[model samples]
Target: MKILITGGAGFVGSALAIALKQNYPHYQVLALDNLKRRGSELNLSRLKAAGVEFTHGDIRSKEDFDALPAVDAVIEASAEPSVLAGLDGTPDYLINTNLFGTVNCLNYALKHKANFIFLSTSRVYPIKTIETLNFVEEATRFALSDEQPVPGVSAKGIAENFPLDGARSLYGTTKLASELLIQEYNEFYGLRTVINRCGVLTGPWQMGKVDQGVMVLWIAKHYFQQQLGYFGYGGTGKQIRDMLHVADLYRLIDWQLHHLDQVNGEILNVGGGLESSASLQELTQVCQEVTGHTIPIKAVAETRTADIRLYVTDNTKVTNLTGWKPEIGIRRIVEDITAWLAENEKDLAPILK
Candidate 1:
């Protein structure tokens, strides 16, 4: 199979490429990215060294899409994934890169008659509905219901059925728009399209940025000697998040490729579920335990725009459909992130600036 992955030089995209090459050796993987992010070049360089084909191109440019090699599948991983960056009269980049970029990708997919997979985010859910959640504070984290059921088993976490139109932030709006675009393309072109509304994805080869990979940044700072900052503490330092390893997503996409007819035009919330969740305080403690450091913690004045209070995904739909769930835990997440940092410390130096 010939596969083309956009944003393949970024964290999730690069790791997906590595996972595909390792697991499906007969398949040919072509990664396309602008390499605009700091250290994205490093990602592409590493992939090239590993024998993956690549093209230096921006999704915003039509010529880039036209130039793409024919492929059996197209993974639309490209996006300006900074929620906060979109708030400061700068959402155009998000729309251009995410919305318009997706249009280009879908068009390319239809033109080539290839299957499409889009990498969406949980942030597509509006912040108002999440804020209205009546979560209670626990010793280590926040519980959705007063009953405090086990992790990965709460209805309060955003499910695929949640109302999506609750005062979306700029970032959320674009993602939501792109999601619509994927569906529309599927209807209009008969394209086999799958939408995975992914939550926090972290693993090796990620140049974790503040806007996109918050969890990875926290892990990198705590264990890898990078500087760290906490925006809010009064949320009890337990603002919970469901994080999944990128490898798990590789499995999902692999499954989708095989069941193209079954998975097409379906939207699924993909994540670590309730079982693989953590808060700022809990993450800090884990970092301390693993790194034997204080893991400095501080507080800021207010929450960033559209910061969800306790964002976890039900992930039951994907589980039911593909029998896929997170195989890695938070502990393994930290260990692998630390290992990635140690292995690529020299290459990551540019982004550390």
Candidate 2:
């Protein structure tokens, strides 16, 4: 089996490629990315060393799409991922990358008769109610629906069944639009497709920016001793998020692709679930434990727009179907990231944008 993964040089894409190569050697993995972002080259090198084929291209280019090798599956990982940055750029770029880019990839995959899996985000849900969920403040974080558990949803976090309609920012609007496109495509083309609305995804090679990958940013700040700001620190710096190891995420994708016939047009929430949720203060402690550094951080007066104060996915659907679970915990994630950074410190400085 051959697979084409867009944004293969990225943190999650590259890790997915490596995981695929290790687990399924018979499967040829081809990764395509524009390599426009910092640390992507290093990510590409990591994948190349793992024996995966690397291709340089943009997902928006028709020539690039036409150039890809025939494959049984296409994992659409490419995106302008920042929910915050979408506000600055023209709606055209947002439409092109988040909306049309996905349309183009789905078209390509359908033309080739390939299964598709999109790396969607939890931001597609409304943030107003999320921030307003009933919660009791803990020493470090907040707890939700404390009175009654809502089966798969309340116990786990945000379930796939959550309404997509509340007030959404520009980023969520674009993703929500694209997700509808994929759902429609699956119905029209009989193409097997699943939208995995992932939570915070972080691993060793992640190039975290101010707008995305907050967990890695936390670790990166400690690793570099860089100046850091805490947005919701007054709330105990306890904004919780379910962060998953990209390797485990690849396993879930592999399971879905192999069992596409069993499920079609399913919008699944993918993440570490409640088990992977962590607060900023907890993460800072992890950083302190990992780096042995009592890092100093400044607190920002306000939180960003569309910020989910405490939202985690209820990944019961995925676990029930695939029997896939995250093997690495948060502590392990911090340790692994610290170790990887320590070994690759010299190379890391160049990639810090």
Best by lDDT: 2
Cα lDDT computed for each candidate against the true fold: 0.80, 0.81
Candidate 1 residue lDDT tens string, 321-353: 888888998989888877777777777656652
Worst lDDT run of 10 residues, candidate 2, spans 146-155
lDDT of 1: 0.80
Clashing pairs in model 1, backbone N/Cα/C closer than 3 A: 152-274
Name the lDDT value of residue 352 in candidate 1: 51
- After superposition, the stretches of candidate 2 with alpha carbons farther than 4 Å from their true spots are 147-155, 233-235
Clashing residue pairs in all predictions, respectively, total 1, 0
What tens-digit string does per-residue lDDT give for candidate 2 at 273-296? 778878887889889888888777
Cα misplacement distance, residue 207 of candidate 1 (Å): 1.7
